[model samples]
Target: MFRWYQRAQVCYVYLSDVSSSVLEGDSPTSLRRKPAIRKSKWFTRGWTLQELIALARVEFFSKEWNSLGDKQSVLLTLHERTGIAVRALEGSPMTIFTIEERMLWAKGRETTREEDAAYSLLDIFDIYMPLIYSKR
Candidate 1:
């Protein structure tokens, strides 16, 4: 998947619930009621980080197959929810952000296996480490 993503000219992202229904008025109370993209299981996955960053051109879609917007239009909202920078989201030529910065994005995210948290980032970081499993 990583290899394919790297070579693909453009990537389309189907954000199943990023529609206007999820976004109400701009009032603080309404904003509080707004659906946060981060809360979605898709955003919480370890592998999704790479998918979000590795692609150069990413198009976002809503649940009803409507186009929410392109990368630029949705970047601020995405960054707010995911804590990833616009630069990284833009897929710069090389990742200028540190590993710690990248890891920060995954802080609240989850994986069924503990090792998957590290394994899913191997390709994104271009590094390898032995995978180990624990009863915890």
Candidate 2:
């Protein structure tokens, strides 16, 4: 999936848990409420981290499918929301950053399945571990 993301022409991120109908207007109210976009659920998911980093160009959409912005347009917000280096968001090779820094990217992300937390990171570290659905 990580490799597929890297080779994709573009990835469209649908923020299903966020509504942009109120923020999409051109009025001053809407413009001032741009910060609302940062509260999207995508930022808290473990799997989306890989998708965000691997995809060269990501076009973000709201639950209503409203065009929020592309990766470049929201780079600063993405950095502030995720604490990911702007260079990484800009497609820098993962090897250039230390393992600690790379691991920090998934610091607060959550996975629904117990083993998924471990699974979510395999690609980021270039490891191939067999799936182990532990009962713990």
Say which candidate scores most in TM-score: 2
TM-score, every prediction: 0.69, 0.86
Determine the C-alpha RMSD for candidate 2 after optimal superposition of all C-alphas. 2.5
Query: Which candidate tops lDDT?
Result: 2
Residue 71, model 1: Cα distance from true site in angstroms: 1.5
lDDT of 1 by residue, 60-122 (tens): 666666655656665776687788887888776435878788778878777888778777777
lDDT of candidate 2 over 1-136, digit per residue (tens): 6777899999888888778766746676435334766888789988888888898899988888888888888888888899888888898888888899989998999999967888888888888867778785
> How does model 2 fare in lDDT?
0.83
- What is the lDDT, from 0 to 100, of the residue 13 in candidate 1? 71
Q: After superposition, how far is residue 114 of candidate 2 from its true place, in Å?
A: 1.5
